[model samples]
Target: MTPSAPPPFSTLIRTASQQQHTEAESSTFMGDLLGGRLGVEAYARYTEQLWFVYRALEEGARALVDDPVAGPFIRPELMRTGALARDLAHLRGEGWRDTAVPLPATSAYADRVTQCARSWPAGYVAHHYTRYLGDLSGGQIIRDRAERTWGFTRRGDGVRFYVFEEIPNPAAFKRSYRELLDGVRVDEVERRRVVEECGRAFALNTAVFRELGEEFPLSA
Candidate 1:
């Protein structure tokens, strides 16, 4: 009898981190924001936190642009800093940068991404996958919510961060991204580490949402 083939690495990672992913998705802040229970200020504040996190994620990408483990995932089209900045400006005017500040959870999240990008390129893949793939997937729900709730123009300035103008086909891009993950040149030990890091990334994201929930509790 032939033994069954093991699941692909992408499947392993996703299955391993499924709980954390669900928890992040089900966080109160996200639920409130997506449900339109929160006001536009809450949404703007959330976008501000994203700006800091994406800056860290993208700023570190330049150093890893040639790394064997992380390089393949560093597609320029996935960059979000400029889009985040545009969203902030539209939400908070030209001086948004002056007022933009990271929540404590956000600072920690960004710092972790920076650390992984600088020290462990393979681990950086966990963060890259957790974030950009998520943006291409569930993040669209956010773009739709923002448009409907806040009356932002469809894929316009306020929600530009969620729009992937470069990737005409997000579903296709995500499939290719999963292929990269499955083919990553890591041994079993490092693959497990990357999987663990994916969980950590989701936990960190949930922390941000938890803090935002505290900051913008639902009204009676």
Candidate 2:
């Protein structure tokens, strides 16, 4: 009998990192934040942390615009820096940038995105896939929760980060993105490295959550 074909790259990535992904989601901070135990202040602080990360990711994408391996994934619609800034401004007032600071874990996460985007295209894709796809998928639930819980206007100034004005069909876009991952040329070793980097991305995200949990401990 013939051997089975290898799994698709997207499936490989999901299967390889499933446990870590769950851990990141189930972290104390995420648990509190998602369960509505935390207030809008906590959510705003989380957005501030995201600003540092997306800034690095988008700036790095600017440098990689010409890369043969990375260029195809450089989607203008996926860029979140501007939306994040607007969200922060609405949440924190005009001087949000002047006062916002990255938590230590956030700095490290941003640094890793910068490093990979500059050096390893596949690794950069690992982070890009982790974040933007999550934003498209699970992030929709987050947007709904924030809106209902905090009374933010629907798809208005406050929750602009979750609104994708460019992409009419997020599900189709995600499928096309996964197909691109499957088509990208990479050897066995590089594929393994990319999968591993995806795990690291989740870990870094969990660290940020852990720090947030510490800062905003749950009440009795």
**Which candidate has the highest TM-score of all?**
1
Clashing residue pair totals per candidate (backbone < 3 A) = 0, 0
Per-residue CA lDDT of model 2 for 102-197, tens digit only, reads 999999999999999988998999999899989998889888888987788999777899999998999999999999889878887899999999
Q: Which stretches of candidate 1 lie over 4 Å from their true place?
A: none
Residue 59 lDDT (model 2): 96
Q: After superposition on all CA atoms, what RMSD does each candidate show versus the true structure?
A: 1.1, 1.1
Candidate 2: pairs in clash: none
Q: Cα deviation in Å at residue 8, candidate 1?
A: 0.6
What lDDT tens digits, residue by residue, belong to model 1 across residues 31-136?
9899999889999999999998899999999999999999999998999999999999999999999888899999999999999999999988899999999999
TM-scores, one per candidate = 0.98, 0.97
For model 1, where is the 10-residue window of minimal lDDT?
211-220
TM-score of 1: 0.98
